[model samples]
Every structure is written in C-alpha cells, then in structure tokens.
Target chain A: MTVKVEKIEGGIPHNTIMVAGLIASVVLVYLTYANVLTGTQYFAFFGGLATVAALVWGSHTIKHLCSYGIGTGVPSAGMMAFGSGVIAMLFATKYGIAAPIVAVILAAVVGAILGYVANNVLNMKIPVMIVSLVEMAVIGALVLMGYAAMMSGSFELSALTTGSVSILGLSLPSYQASFLGGALIATAFMLGGIAIQHPFNACLGPSWTQDRMLYLAAECGFLSMIAAAIMSMPLISMGAALVSLFVAVIGWYYTYAKYIELSKRDAFSWLDSKPIPEVEGQ
Target chain B: MESIVFGIGITALAGALATVAGAAENTESDIGSQGDPNSQVQLAPQMGYLHRIFNKAIAGEPPAWGLWIALGAGIAWAFMAMQVNPILAIVLGAALATFVQGVYATTAYLGRTASLAKFGQPVFVDVLKSMTTVTMAHAFVAIFATVTVCHLMNAALGHPFPLPLLGLVWGIALGAAGSATGNPFYGKERQYQNQKYGAGVPIAASGNIVRYAEAGERNSLDNGWFSARLGGPASGVCFGLIVFLELWRTVLFEHIAAGWGAIIIGIIIILVFMVIDRYIEVWARKNYGPYGKPAEEASS
Candidate 1:
C-alpha cells in the first residue's frame, strides 16, 4: 500500500516556474497592497498564497536533500531558508523597484556562504548543504517578500508597521499602533514559513510525493493568509476575514484529499480499523 | 473602537493558533534515522569543537557554554547598545545570536548519528535533515515567537524595552534548553529507533531523550498525540511567557543599575529560567515518559 514517489529533482524548467511565480506574485501582490492594482486588496491574499506555492520549490529541494538527511531535521532546512530570507527582505525593502532583483541576489549569495561554511568550515561534510542552503535562502527571501507584499501591500518597513495606525478613530498612541503591527507581522513571518516547512516534514517517507506535498504547501499558505487576514483586519476591508477563510477552506479541501488518499495508499492493513490480536510467542 | 478590540482578539487568536500549528508541524522534524529505506548515504565528517561542546550539554552534562555564551553576548550587546544605538543593536544581536545557537545545537545533535555510518548510514543527508527540522523549530517557536511577543508588548503596551537584549538572553536560554531537552529526546528515540530500524546510537533510559517519535510502530506518525501536538508548543509558550515577563522586568527597572542592569537581569533570567525549565522537564518526563526499553536492550 506504500505509494512510491521517484526522487524528485527539479531542473531548470521547474526552477524557472518557481522563481517566476515568486517574482510575479511579489510584484503583483505589492501592487495590490499598495492599491495600484485594479482589483481589491484581497487579491494580495491570493498573492501571498502564490508566493508560498512558489516556495514549494524550496520545500521540494528540502525533500530531495533531506532524503539524504540533515542531522538537525527537515525544519532546520526551512529555518535556514527563511533565516536568510528575512535579512534579504530587509535589504530589498529599503531599496525601491530593485527589491526583487536585489533580494534574489542577496539570497543566493547568503545561501551560498552559509552552505560553504557548513560544509568547509563547520566540517559537517554535508555535500548538498551548499546547494540546498542556496535554494533555501532564495526561497526564504521569496516567502518573506511575498508575504510582506501580500500583507502590507508593499515591501516598505512602514507598510509592515503601520497596521495599527489604520484602526479607525482610535487614535491609539503611536507605540501601541506600531507594536501591534510588529507583533502581527511577526506572527505571519513565523507561521508562513511553517506552511512551507510542514509538508515535507509531515508527509515524508518512501510514499511521499511532490504533488501531494505541494498541495499541503498550498494549504499551509492559506493558513498563513488567515493569520495575515486576522492581523491586517484593522487595515483592510471587512472582507479580509471571509476571503481568507474561503481560500483556506478551499485549499484545505485539496490538501486533505491528497492526504487521505496518500494515507490510505500507505496504510498498513493490520493498523486499519480494528487491531488484530497478537499471536502467542513463537 | 469595537473593531480595534475585535482586531486584538482576532490577532491573539490567530497568533495562538498559528503557534500551535507551527509547533505541531515542527514536532515531526525533531527526529531523523539512518536506516530508512528512502535515505541516501553521504560524506561522514568528524565533529568539531563547538559540536563537542554542544554534545556535552545535550548529553545532560552541565552546559558549560551557557554562561560563557551569555556573558560574551551580553558584553557584545552592551557595548553595541551603549556605543552605538540600543534598539537596532538588540534586534540584530538577538537575530544573529539566535542563528548561531541554532547552528550550534544542530551540529551536536547531528553528530550523534556517527555510529550509524558503519551500518551504512547517509551521514551527510541525515544530519542536514535533522538540522533542518530542529533549527527551524528553534527559529520559529523560540526565536521568532519570543521576539514578536516582546515587540507587541513593547510597542502596543507602551513599555521602555530594549528589544535585542531580551532577544539575546532568551535566545541563549532557549538554545541551551533546546540542547538540553534535545539530548534526552534523541536518546530515547534512538533506543526505540535502533531496535525498530536496526542498531545505531545508544541512548540512556533515565528519561534521557523525551521520546519525540510517537509510540507504537517504529516511526509511525500516529499513536503519541501529546508529544506532537501539546508538548512542544506548550513548552514553547511557557518559555516565551517567561522570556517576556523577565525581559519586561529588566526594561521596566533598568534605572536601578545604570546600563549594566540588563547584564544582571540577563543572568538572573538564565538561572531562574533554567530552574523553571528543569521542573517543566521533570513534569514532562513524569507525565509523558518514554515508551521504549533501554538502548542496549532494545537494540539487542
């Protein structure tokens, strides 16, 4: 009953799709958040989802490399990716128009440096540590920038911190608004990364498949969007919650379907339904 | 007014929910094995000094590194805060130190799998996967969650806070705790794991490793709900709350010791947190104890 997925190696085309999705989602989401886009700001919600979907490439890299095993665990790979991501995002946000390009470059360089250190200086001798880390770094940047774009409507620091200011008529003290915003974004940042890391870690085994994992990745992304919606509800229109819930529910459908299928496909018969009585000692 | 309150409620609810979900997913990443049929072998490298230091801590020896790491980090932070700017320095310092601790803990944790190489282990890949899981868990649950909460309190609650200083203290504490907790969890799991999959590393049964993997079938994701869903996040939230309260005190009472107050506060925090964390550990052990036999017996 084990569903066997081949070793998934994403080549140039696959990588291109992920990168393209990341850029497109970030740019479009940013525009939507900034009110430059034609549609409602809620489109940025989907953009956030897309950004996470793109990061699925990074997750796939984790799956492929983790099959080799990272001594710390699968989540370490995701953390490393996102760790570099937040830094690159900080730098990119400070620069306008050049944000995506700058972030990508910084992510690659940072990831490479981290990988080199782990392999050479750290002497851990993880062969793919360099490439996996490099990919993870880029994915991390995309996730951060993409999430930022979706939530704040732009990559600017102010956009991220200004959530509390949008609360109508409260005239809440400056500190209160700023603190509220920071907390909210921090939540999104932490949780969004989870969406990417969770699929590979949870579903891994011989029976794991990239397609199924990607579905879970989308579900995770939707879950993150829900967090974003809750955080940004003060800033955005009332529909943010409903829309976010709608997307999450829909995404969960696909993710859960694949999960059930995979589980059934991989289940051991003895563990199904009732447990069989144990035989006497041989 | 009504909406703001509603927003606050939703944010807290969402943050808590996300924290739970993230922590649960993180639980899966805590363990890796060498004998998996799907695994591939890679280069086996020797452990370094830092890894050895971390190993001692993980193996339940008094963590010699905590005091030194904290003192060193505190000095660096104080210098930066006094000489340069306070806020940015704290943030960067915390962020950087957390990342460093993440690497330190992960390296030692991975080193334990060296024994599996003789039995055809994919040392490199396994280590990386293991590192990936635990590091991310530390980063998300311990580091980010703590920082976010601190910022929320500082800004929203209108406290005079030094963000990074709190982050640094909490980071070191969490790192130490993660290392300390990790050793036993790894020990117990390896015992059950070696028996289930084949011989590998030895683990003490004195509740050494906290049995991260669920009970029942080897590596089965089902069976143990407590470890996966509750244990990690519950501990994480508790740790975060402790960090918040302690750091809040330091910032609130910084006038007491000139600039050096944070250092004193930091040390007190480490000591107090360690004590509380130990009790928490004992409670966890007493309640959700390991399900496996001794490593020797199980593997045999």
Candidate 2:
C-alpha cells in the first residue's frame, strides 16, 4: 500500500497547528499568571513547545519555506521560541527565571543550529536512511548517557508510535524505534515524489529536462529524509535497519509520486489554459 | 543625529533577527545527492567567466590575509575591548563559537530535513545558503560568548558586567561586523555576481577567486589613474579605520552609556563594510572576471 504523509488525510493544517499551539501558550501564560497551573501541567506545556520547535526547525518543512513557501511564516520559527519559553517553564519551579531562560536558550540553540544545517550544510537532501542512521546514532548516544530529556515525554509526536514492545526489562527505546521508522517513511515519500513527477515532462530539451529531474528528486529527498530523521529517532528501538527498511520504500514512493503527480498536474492545467493558484510549495 | 541612532538600532535589530533566526532555523543541504547546489540560496553565482578572470589574475595562491585578519583582529579587538589577556579571549571565544555553531548547524540541519521529509515536502537544495550567515552569526555568537565569559571572568576578578546587556552589545557588534565582511564576500555576488576585494584577501595567482562582485573599476579607461586601482582594500583601510578606531574606543567605555555608544559606532562601521562587501567587493571580483592571470596571455 502506498503511504502518503503529504496532504495527511483530514489531518490538521500546518497553520492550524501553529495557531493552536499559540493559543495554548497564551492560555498557559494566563493560567500561570493566574496561579492556577499545577507544576506538572506547566512542565508538560514547556516540554510540548520544545518538542514542536525542535521538530519544526529540525524538519524538512524549512525547505518548503525556501522553495514552495510552506512553513516560512513567523509562527513557524516563532514556534520554537514559544516552545523554548514553554520548556523553560518546566524548570521554573526548580530554577526560577534562570530555568526558563536557560531552557529556551538551549532549545533555541539546538533547534536553530539543526535547522540551519538542514538548510545549509546537508543541502537538505541526504538519503532517508542516511539521515535516520545519523540521527539515531546521536539519539542513541544521548539515551546511553542517560540524557534523553526531550524524547522521554514527547506526547505531541507520539502519533508515529504503533505499539510499544519491551525487550530488556524496560521499553526498547520506543522513541528511537519511532524515529528510525519515521526516517524510513520520509525516504519512501521522496522516492514516490520523484517517481510520479519524472515521466510526463518529456517535452523539454535534454539538459533542461535532466536538470528538472534533479531538482524534483532533490526536493523530495530532502523533505522526506529530514522529516523521518527528526520524527522517527525515538521510535528506532525496533532496530535501526528494521525500522529503516520498514518505512523507507513507502515514504520514498509517496513523496516522489506526490511531486511527480503535482508536476504533471500543474503541467496539464497550463495546457488547458487555466491559471493555477500557487500551491503550498511552489 | 537621532536618525543615526535609529538606523543603528534598526540595523542591529536586523542582524539580531537574522542571528536569532539563523540560530533557530535549521538548514542542511546534501551535495552530489538529489540536492540542488542552488537550493542553498546565495546572492553569488557559483560559477562565472568573471570568476575565471580573477582566478587567472591571481596567478599565485591567495595569502592568508582575511583569515589572519579575522584571527588577529579578533584577538586585538578583544584585548582593546577587555584588557584581561587579549589572546586568551580571542582563542577561547573563537574556538568555542566555531565548535558550538558548527554542531548547532549539523544537528539542526539533520532534524529539519527529517521533519520536512516526514510530510513528503521538498527540502531546499543550495550549497552556500547558510555559509555566510553562519560565519557572520558566529561573529555575533563569539562576541556574545566572549562577553559572557568575560563577565564571569570579571566577577572572578571582582568586577562584573551586566550579563544580559553585554550579550546584546557583543552580539550586535560582531553581527554587524560579520554582515559587513563575510556577507559581501560570500552573499553579495549571488545577487549582483560582480564584485571583488583585494589587498586584505589574497586569492590564487590565477585569480581563482570565484566571486560575484569585483573591486573598484578594474576595467575603466582611467585604470591608468591611481585612484581606481588603489580604491579597494587599500582605500578601504584609511576610510573605515578612523571610524573603526573610534568605535573600538567605545567598546572599552569607562561607563555603560559609552558601551552603548561604542556599539552604535561599531554598527556604523559594520554597515559601511557591509555596503562595500556587497556592492564594491563583490562587484570588483565579478568585474575583474575571476582571480587569475591578466587579459594579455589569453589561452583562448
């Protein structure tokens, strides 16, 4: 079965997610100011924000902002800042002002650095498993060192989880398993993205046509690879290779096909002489 | 003038914004993969005839001027700013900044790409997208980190600077400087793709410095005159140094307000350099047509 992560079936719009989170933060602040929020609730709020910021900054969606104008809004980057503030709240009871400030600062540093590299160093197009393996390695190291702060409580991204399986006394790093699986999913998407887009554009000249394919493949690869790596690491306790193989083919196919189909569709709409509105990632 | 302060503030704000944005935003592009070198969005064209010309003109390898300057100025600047063992601050701050920002870029890059791919989104494909920004951001990061480290050091030495405001000042100062220097060299040409810088930066004897901008009027009929050829790195020295010195003095402000004034002056210096970095330096390099051997002995 073809798995499509794009155009999630009746899933919340990216913007809606932002707005919802913003509201949550506002309410959180209001509640905190009102002295109504319990300590646990506040920490949870902060944790959620950090996870989202880290995810967004760490995601391939950043590429969308540069190309298709998907997640480039103020709220997108602001999500991390808000998340940082929220995460800081987690340590507020213990550290006071320093807690939130330090948490947000660290979160921002982590999120932004990863985001910058995703856009800059990697050129945002490493292969799915490649990104997954690298992230898993780091996440694993983190887990080993007993510093799995972010993953221990990321209920927001828990949707990637299927069911927890125990191996050695405790859970088999459910977050790591999810992360590896997600990376595979991202890879499958781009493969699909390129597969669907390449065939129909046979009309262009040789060099022009080849360049177009490269561009498409790059986009699909970058997005999926990044997404899977960030979202799937914690889920990767299923074994890196297993999780990678599980999601790789499907993620690549859907993502590649989605773009290929979009390209063909966009190409055809122009043929019928209809102007198409600029879609999410132009 | 009030306009100057406002402009300084606004400029500082812009650098700060980009710094924070760069700090927060994730950018990772793969090369030789499905990634597009273009996706890295830079103002300078990666390849050009002008770049070839400069490469040919350079004839020899570029001297380590820019690098040395960055290293040396960094130390000197630190010493002047804070007399607590200047070289120590430079080495420590620059090293720390490089390592920190480097890891930050690597992890952020990985995380961002993974997320985008999660939804089957297309990741950007550019090579130089974050190169200049990261370098310049380091200017800010290093400055801020230095200040913080210095602040702690000061406390240990029975003196302390306001932690928050010191970060703000150091960040703004270095950011403005970086935007002025690195951006023009790396960022400007992708836009104009015709600029250059000389003297301070030694390129290949073949002028292999492939940049978008060129310095001064390399091809003017008046190339015979002293003004045009002498204008770039050489002229830049006299023109900007006075102001640079004044600002340096300000960073060592005996009073807090002086520090603010110093930051403002430093911003001006940075802005001036940025203008040159973008317009003049880049234009010169591009116009000069690569850093290489002159037009006479053409292999063509």
Candidate 3:
C-alpha cells in the first residue's frame, strides 16, 4: 500500500561509487588508447574496442544503480566536456598520434577533473547557466590550444580545414550513393540513440538521457577525421561515402535533434545544493 | 544599470505579489483553520507563481539564458557539422535546440511537488485556470522582448541575415517546437515508466507547479494517456521534422532570410490558438499537471 521513496541519508555509498566510476573510467581509457592499429583496419579494430568499452565499462552498467545511469545532466555534462575534447582532437590531429595518444589522455584528464569538480566539489546543482560557462571555457581553450598546435607545425591551421582538403581513400559510383548513405546513417544514429535510451529508462528509474549524448559523442569521436574522404566526389565511392555520409548524418541528428529534450532521457538531473547562477560577466 | 533595474523591478513585483497573496491566503486560512492542516503559513500559491516568474525573468534565468545558451550552443554545435559538411549545421542546431528544450521542460515539470499546493484555501486548480492570463503576459513579453533583443544583438554583431529578425524567428520556431516537445506520454501505469511501487505520479503533470506541490499530499498524478508520452523519444521525431523543414529552407535553399520565416509561422499558430481557446489555449491543456498529481490525491 505504501512504498516510500527514501533519500539515502545523502546517499554516501552511491556518490562514492559514482566518483570511483569516474576515476576508473578515466584510467581504463589509457588501455583503449594503448593499442591503435593505423588505417582502415584500425577503424574496425580499435573503434570496435571503444564501442565495447562503452558497452561494458562505460555508464551502461551503472544504469542499474543510477536512475539515470549514463543518461543524466551530470553525466551528460561530463560527456560534453570529454566529447568536446575528442572532437577537438579529431580536428587537430592527423588521426595518427592524436587518436592514439593525445585525445584519450586529454579526454580522461579534463573530463574526470570537470566531472569530479562539478559533481563532487561545486555540486553542479545549478541551472543551465553553468553549461554555457563550461562550453565557453572548453571551446575557447580548444581553439586557442588547437591554434597553437597548428601554428607550431608548419602547416596553416586554417588552411588545413578549408574545403580544399583532398578526398582520399575509396571512390563512389555516383552522388546518389553519398546522399543515400548520409540519410541512412543519420537515421541510425538518431534512432539508435533513442532506442538505447528507451530500454535503459525502462530499467533505470531515471530517463538515462546521457546515453543519447554519449552515443552521439562516440559516433563523432571517430567520424570527424575521415569525413572528407567519405564526402568528396570522384574519389568518394558509394561504400566509403556511405560510411562518411551516414556518420555525418547521424552526428547531425544527435547533436541537433536528439540532443534536445525529444527523448526526455536526461530528465532526472543531479539536484545539487546550490544552483548555478547566471554568469554576470565574461 | 538597466539589467539591475529590471532585476530589482521583477524581484520587487514578485515579492509584493507574494506578500499580498500570502497575506490574503493567511487571512482566509485563519478563518477556515478548523478543517485544514495547512495553516502553517509557510507556503503560498502566489509564491509558486513568483518563484516561476523570477526564474523566467532573471537575465540569465532558464527562460532568458536558455535563449543565449541555445543560440550560442546552436552555433557552436554547428561546428560539429563543419566536420560532417556545411549543410549538417542547420540540421544539427535545430535538433539540438529541440532536445535541450524538451529535457529542461520535462525536467522542470517532473520535479514540482503537489503537497505544497494543498496548503491553502481557494483551491490550487483555480489558480491554475489563470495560467492562461499569466502565460499570455509572459509570452508577449518574451516575444517582443526576444525579438527586440535579438535584433539589437544582430546589429551589435553586424546584422547577419536580417539580424534581430532571426531572433524572432528563432523564438517562434522554438516556441512551436516547444509546444510539441512539451507534449509526451506520462502516467503511473504506463509500461515504459513501469510503475511498480503503486505508480508514483506520472511525470508530465510537473508543468503545473501549483497542482504539483498541493497534490503531493494525496493519491494523485493519474493524468491518463497524455502523461505517459511526455518523456518519450517520439518528441525527438517531431523535432527532426521541424529541423528538416527549417534546414531545407535556410541552408539548402541558400535563403538565409528563410530562417526568420519560422517565427512568422509560429506567431500565426499562436494567434490562431489564442483566438479559439481560453487559458487552455496557451499550454497543451493536458488536463493534468506534471508533479505526481497534487500530494493529497491517491498515490497513483
């Protein structure tokens, strides 16, 4: 007749587990980075590992303990920081040393620190204003650091990303293939994120909204580097282009559409003590 | 000076309203003290409205900050598209904005408490009926205020693509989608929610903070079919459609002006609905509130 929803005396054990998970996750990431086979073979090889890692080691299992599991505001914000770093690496590195070394290290370090501080120290219970502050800091840091990284190297950083980058790898038969691939992948990522979040919320009491954001981040993690090869014509083939197009399309859907409240997976957020106030100054 | 002045004005108004309403409720509660246990005089119906209004009016409050955050996040998020292709930016921004809006709204709704609502006379639902009046006030202020500020921001930034007009369009476009995002399944017995422990109130009724707080005292929150879908990803698909149309018009057609067009469409929709409906017109009239049906109702 009466089932009381009890708050766990400030839930000490649960908070410890969460903090431990963050530390463990950041550390284990070193292993994911340790073995990176270069080339198309590497895509299937290490990319497979990353996905598996996300499945086994990432927040999926934690879903049992947490109402939100991987889908939550605190987790989402953590992923945003980590994901931003990964995306930045995707842009800055040659997919050689960057993916293997720099990206993983930076993601683990920056993400864990931000996560620990926000959840544990600052008690990230504030409104969305902190998100803006976090974004500005992360992006601003990335841009400045990335600019320096680009400058130290002889290549012009601006020129590197300009539309002129040559399309290498495989070639597609027709433009239709590229279009078709993009559309299909976009749907998969969008639907996949939704699908994952759906079953998760059923299991975890919370909506698990972070799952959608994380999946989007993971998808973008690898896709950013080889996108041009997938998009360019003459060199772009239906298969590779499909790969590129789908990857791009999915990223587009998740970042824009699915990332919004459409799924409600991120519904139950970390209710911290002090709400983050609106930023009054730069 | 302007920001501080506005903040003080809003804070004072909210305070004044709370004082008058709380006093009025107190006087009435004292007269009727024999029956109701809610005479502690801690919570006030007007205070609920005030809490909400302050959150809305604060310069960096969710209502106000959401715009800048949404806009900035939208534009920066577009960079992810740069990795994919130029066209993906528009698609990404719309979808992202939609999701953010949905999550915040749903999150806001679910956290509301119904037990707080019942602590008074002049039933909370009566206050809820007046939502139309307040929502209209806020919406007009939001629209003109948003459009004007957007225009000014555009001028400040050198007027890219009709400048402030884009803000109006962005607002309307968001508002319309806001309507859709706000719509979803919720209820205690729903399979997705798996209401095992006697179904704690459906998460959708959170939109009505008054009912949410007051109803917390009883077995309530059985808002039926509409509440169940409130948190589902179906809203995502709806967001996709909006993003697609806007993207095709603004990015693909190369008619950047079309970006503002959605605002016109949003305005027309709101106007039509306003003309036909009463207080129920502005909100989805879900016939339910979000916070587990005021606390006084049955657990379900």
Q: How many residue pairs clash in each candidate?
A: 36, 181, 74
Candidate 3, which segments miss by more than 4 Å at Cα? A1-46, A60-92, A120-122, A125-202, A205-282, B1-300
Share of reference contacts kept by candidate 1: 0.00
Error of 3 at B122 (Å): 44
lDDT of 3 by residue, A1-282 (tens): 112222233323433443443344333333323323321211222222232223222223233223322233322332243344434444444554333344445544554455457555766442322333233223322322222221111112231233212236433233222212212122112212222222222222222233443343333322221222222321222353344445445554554354333323343232222222222231
Please list the C-alpha lDDT of all candidates, in the order they appear: 0.47, 0.29, 0.30
Q: Which tens-of-lDDT digit does each residue in A51-76 have in candidate 2?
A: 22223222222222312222122122
Model 3 root-mean-square deviation: 19.1
Estimate the TM-score of every prediction: 0.56, 0.30, 0.31
Q: Pick the candidate with the highest DockQ.
A: 2
- Count steric clashes of candidate 2: 181
Write the number of the candidate with greater lDDT, choosing between 2 and 3. Answer: 3
Where is the poorest 10-residue window by lDDT in model 2 chain B? B52-61
Reference-based lDDT, residue B29, model 2: 12
